[model samples]
Target: MGHVPTRLLSHPCATRSPPMKERKAIESWLTDMDGVLVHEGEPVPGAPEFVNRMKESGKPFLILTNNSIYTPRDLQARLYRMGFDVDENSIWTAALATAQFLADQRPGGTAYVIGEAGLTTAMHAAGYILTEFEPDYVVLGETRTYSFEAITKAIRLISAGSRFICTNPDATGPSNEGLLPAAGSVAAMISQATGVKPYFVGKPNPMMMRSALNAIGAHSETTAMIGDRMDTDVLCGLEAGLETILVLTGISSRLESETYPYRPSRIINSVADLIDEI
Candidate 1:
């Protein structure tokens, strides 16, 4: 991780080129879950205070995550345990976004799914039939256990002509044991076998950002996306035309962000620094 510059710490709003009124148009916010708010299932320092400030300010915001293993209710409960008081409605996951995409593209379609309750439940709620017999789509999502047999079945199904879809493109995820192969890694294996690339609906795709903004009834021009990773959060927010803030509390660092061609609208030490802005 790169060290945050002292200049950014001294002037939090220095990056905003727009005038005061235009800057004040930023009434909504979207934030990454893992690195921005929590680290390894624990709340980041001052994360709770920042969250409470958002609520008190009455600004529309959503806590976004690419992890598709857990539902909003599950995440809400987890955050509650971590000392943050976020409501389930204010949480959005890749699973929900994927389901929304499928429903829009192929309503009431059948799918062969390889995911846990979060993904499956959303698909079912969208009126999708989950099956293995010539399904309309082959959906992949994160799971605690990835079964070889399931992957084999997915490969066969995709080879047989089902459209391929994945929740996110994360190749690996952090775990207590260490880094573990995630949905993107497994998706690559399946893609290699069937010669078909799965369409990822998560961050860095920009679709996730658009969907999240719509969920909160926020306009991109008036919304700011706060994230830890430049490739995913900042990239997607930029693509979606939202102001992007990279907080140095997770994966990407201040120096690492410079390596990228694009730049965030602002950089802050952490979510802690944004409480005053709220």
Candidate 2:
């Protein structure tokens, strides 16, 4: 919605580095959907080219999104609506990863969800029974209609000793207007109610990264996790033993990197810069 920050490209960090070292075997890329490729529903600059270049080069890639609110089909349609030609199978959300984990842990068990239809649908499709009754697991994600009643129910089940699992830890997502509560907000509420920490299974979590790599059939050594969020995207890549590339076109600022222990393997201003480098 605003001008693309120029400092992201011409920042002091860029001058010190002799251009990004050539991309290491990056045969496959695991990319974040929201901030890395698009923002507030619009493709970031050079996003189409970046994706098309990968397609042209015959390198495989998948959109690894932490947002569990949307399914692969939903995301594919959204990308198409945004003018990007993306394959549906190339999309993987925290919802899918979380569902896979839950299915393995407690197959067919009832799950109490505090998120959107996508989370519920994925879990159900994965053979987990969806119920508002006392569930074995209380899963949390992005629920736009996250009301007091929903939180109350989730807290009740969690306090009753149900295993609490969160899709992600992101507190906010960008909008055309401003930032809004994300999946992590619901997770925080449940944690306060249950006095227990949730097992996060999204970006920054190796499980999510592992699932993406497995789906793309790429080795961690040859995989790249590209995103704009430092705490989630870059950190997840670092955890997965993959190369972490930080694009400043979204939430994180260059100065903020000094505060986190999760240092990115490389930092670029935007996906456009990545295109420029390639």
* Best-performing candidate as measured by TM-score: 1
Tell me the tens digit of each residue's lDDT in model 1 across 1-278: 79989888678476655564345467999999999999987889999999999999999999999999998999999999999998999999999999999999999999999999899988998899999999999999999899999999999999989999999999999999999999999999999999999999999899999999889899998899999999999999999999999999999999999999999998999999999988
Instruction: Please list the residue runs of candidate 1 whose C-alpha ends up more than 4 Å from where it truly belongs after superposition.
Output: 1-24
- N/CA/C clash count, model 1: 0
Error of model 2, residue 41, in angstroms: 2.9
Candidate 2, 187-232: lDDT as tens digits: 7877877798999998778999998888778898888889887888
- Give the distance in Å from residue 255's predicted Cα in candidate 1 to where it truly belongs: 0.6
Worst 10 residues of 2 by lDDT: 14-23
Top candidate when judged by lDDT against the true structure: 1
Q: After superposition, how far is residue 184 of candidate 1 from its true place, in Å?
A: 0.5
lDDT of 2: 0.83
Please give the lDDT score at residue 194 for candidate 2: 76
